[model samples]
Target: MEPRFLLLSDVAAELNVSDSQVYHMVRSGELPAIKIGGRGQWRVERARLEEYIAAKYAETAAWVAKNPLVDREDEA
Candidate 1:
């Protein structure tokens, strides 16, 4: 690992969300971040970003599993 870190804009672009959403995530503690200075600059660790993406995927999978479509058929 190269100790990668992402700026707020990069994270917002990666997540396809607004900058404010990223700010909210940081404030709400949904996403881990660090302040660089007194200018409210925030950075997210690459590892943490990956973890959050994985967790979101898992959550979506669980939701889909619990709410299967009525017309869907199991191929097995």
Candidate 2:
């Protein structure tokens, strides 16, 4: 079975990003995460990570719609 929560490194690996980037996202509140244990290490719920990915997809779609790519051929 899949784990219910993931470490920052695991999340980063899944997203193909750096662990520090994931930490920053959690710190900035751009991504949802929870601190556990006495050391307060961060953990992201699998469902929340999925939600974040879906939200980014929608955000990117909106941005692409607003800023349609210009064909380089048309620039000449």
Candidate 3:
């Protein structure tokens, strides 16, 4: 498969997040990226992005499961 690359604006639109957020992710090494000249570029493999999202979702789910409300009825 051809490697797909997206500009900061396009990535922000697709993620429904601000451009800065994507930039931060790249800066913090949370998201994979490549540097081209003076610009930091992000090139995400579609499968890798999907895996990251899935891992994040699972982490959130695990946290919720571990921190269940004290009052079970109140949770309902």
Candidate 4:
């Protein structure tokens, strides 16, 4: 079966970003994560990560609505 959780590096790879950036997002509470390691390692739930990505897409759509582009320069 596929894993239900992923390491910080795995998440970073999935998002195509640096591991540090993923850490920052988790630290900032933008992305949900859990600290389960005895040495304090972090892990992310696959469902939560998918939710975060979907939220970003929603946010981008909202931004587009707020700042629409004209079909032609002359129409602006």
Candidate 5:
């Protein structure tokens, strides 16, 4: 069965970033995570991670809307 929650390292591995960077993102609230268990380990819900990625795409689209690219040929 697939797991619904991922460990910090698992999230980092999936995102292709260092574990510390993932930790920083979670600390800054850019990503959501929960610290549970007797060791206070962090767990990131898969659904929330998907939401965060979709939000980033929406944000990038909004940015592009405000800064349209111009064709270089028109500058001649």
Candidate 6:
């Protein structure tokens, strides 16, 4: 079974991004995460990660819809 929470490295690996990038996202509150243990290690909830991905997909779709691709033939 999949884990309920994931380490920052795991999240970074899944997103194909750097660990620092994920850390920054968490710091910026763009991606929800929690600090645990005496060492204050970061962990992201599985459900929250899924929600973040879905939100990104929706955000990208909105951008694409707003900025329609123009046909190059019209310029030629």
**Cα RMSD (Å) per model?**
4.0, 0.8, 3.4, 1.6, 1.5, 0.7
Per-candidate Cα lDDT values, in order, are 0.91, 0.99, 0.72, 0.95, 0.92, 0.99
Candidate 4 backbone collisions, by pair: none
Q: Report backbone clashes per prediction.
A: 0, 0, 0, 0, 0, 0
lDDT of 6 by residue, 1-76 (tens): 9999999999999999999999999999999999999999999999999999999999999999999999999878
**Which ranges of candidate 4 are over 4 A from the true structure?**
none
Per-residue lDDT tens digits for candidate 4, residues 1-76, read 8689999999999999999999999999999999996898899999999999999999999999999886797786
Error in Å for residue 68 of model 1: 0.9
Q: After the best TM-score superposition of candidate 6, give how far the Cα of residue 38 lies from its true spot, in angstroms.
A: 0.4
Taking all chains together, each candidate's TM-score versus the true structure is 0.82, 0.95, 0.67, 0.89, 0.85, 0.96
**Which regions of candidate 6 are displaced past 4 Å?**
none
Off by over 4 Å in 1: 1-3, 72-76
- What is the per-residue lDDT of model 2 for residues 1-76, given as tens digits with 9 covering 90 to 100? 9999999999999999999999999999999999999999999999999999999999999999999999999999
Comparing 1 with 5 on TM-score, the higher-scoring candidate is 5
Shift in Å, residue 40, candidate 4: 1.1
Q: TM-score for model 1?
A: 0.82
Which consecutive 10 residues in model 5 have the weakest lDDT in total?
1-10
| lDDT of each residue in 1-76, candidate 1, tens digit only | 5559999888999999999999899989999999988886899998899999999999999999999877545643
| Number of the predicted model whose TM-score against the real structure is largest | 6
